[model samples]
Target: MFHAVAKGTPYSWANRYCYTGMFCWWGSTTYRRANSPGAAVDTGWGLKFFE
Candidate 1:
């Protein structure tokens, strides 16, 4: 689905993280939704949801 966002190689390089404690949160390349291809473990920290 994301491969059609720009029309390039349908790919990009980024670092995404998922946390499940205190307040789980995720991070990635700020504009494009690159959260569909990574995973993370809980460290008992911050806020948000992960894909």
Candidate 2:
């Protein structure tokens, strides 16, 4: 989870989570494993996955 990855509230970890969330939201679709059905939508725009 984001909380676990952001141990000690590290800046880099937080940034990575933010970026990954963005990528999953804009790159991966609702049907993809990365984006579940109940999860956020993906725009598939100028985003690069895992970025």
TM-scores for all candidates: the values are 0.17, 0.14
Worst 10 residues of 2 by lDDT: 16-25
lDDT tens digits, residue span 2-50, model 2: 3223445656644454323333435442333454565454434443344
Off by over 4 Å in 1: 1-13, 23-51
The most accurate candidate by TM-score is 1
lDDT of 1 by residue, 1-51 (tens): 021223344444443233333434555424334457654332333334333
Report residue 38 deviation for candidate 2 (angstroms): 3.8
Model 2 spans with C-alpha error above 4 angstroms:
1-31, 39-43, 49-51
Clash count per candidate: 4, 0
